[model samples]
Target: MNKLLVITVLVALLALSAESFRMPRQAEEDQGTLTKITDAVKTYYTDAVNTVSGYVDSVKGLQLEEKAKTLYTDTTNVMSTYAGILQDQLYHIFYHN
Candidate 1:
């Protein structure tokens, strides 16, 4: 009868509404996961850049006089520090970060 058909349609509509509401919760969880991953990547990249910049500044600060002895010593020290920094950064980027 007419009442039976109307009741059936209302039940179907209610089921569809329930499904629609659940979908938004699933979508929000997925979006939050993506945001967390993006933020982690951003933080790693920023730390790597800052560490590299510091190494560059330290090397640039090394100034030796006209004598080759002082220049050689300074260069050796700066090169060792630079190498260590680069190694640490690469390790983080590849393994940790």
Candidate 2:
């Protein structure tokens, strides 16, 4: 009887040890998941606010004009050059050639 009792206790200990090494329990993982969800929601709201403000600025035709000009002038220049080249090529193909 004593030997049987000892065997049962040993089996219980082994089962608990195996469980300790298993995947994270639901409650523990849930806190991390909840924090990630909260951060995502905050990021989404911030982006939404920025978008709405941009639209409001557009109604005044003032979507941060100076900032846009400073940031986009180089890009605009590159695009304009490419467009001019394309136009020249098209003109030659259809009219000049």
Candidate 3:
């Protein structure tokens, strides 16, 4: 939405600049400059959109099994660590008393 708005504004500016009260040659020159700017902006946004879309597609293409394995490993490791800590505390309080 924001990108569209910016493009719209740039087009509007280009139109306005083309009808400037300046001399004919200057008007033509200004139109060329504005056209170049609009083209550059369009190219930049097109590349950016394509890059982001590619990233999203890559993420979506990930194997669910890989993600599940990672999550499972992380959770198991955390649980084991916490269990060890609790066991140590309990041993010191109940057995070492």
lDDT (CA) for every model shown? 0.70, 0.71, 0.81
Worst 10 residues of 2 by lDDT: 12-21
Most accurate candidate by lDDT: 3
Ranking by TM-score: 3, 1, 2
For model 3, how many clashes?
Answer: 0
lDDT (10s digit) by residue, model 2, range 1-97: 9989967865654454342446765554455544555556558769999999998978668647776787799899999999999999999999973
* lDDT by residue for model 1 (1-97), tens: 9989967765654454343444645555454544555556558769999999999888767643346687798999999999999999999999983
Over the stretch 1-97, how does candidate 3's per-residue lDDT look in tens digits? 9989987898796685464456545544455666777778779889999999999888879877799999999999999999999999999999884
Error of 2 at 42 (Å): 0.2
Number of clashes recorded per candidate: 0, 0, 0
The Cα error of candidate 2 at residue 15, in Å, is 36
Give all TM-scores, in the order shown: 0.35, 0.32, 0.44
TM-score of 2: 0.32
lDDT of 3: 0.81
Off by over 4 Å in 1: 1-31, 64-97
Off by over 4 Å in 2: 1-31, 62-97
Error of 2 at 39 (Å): 0.2
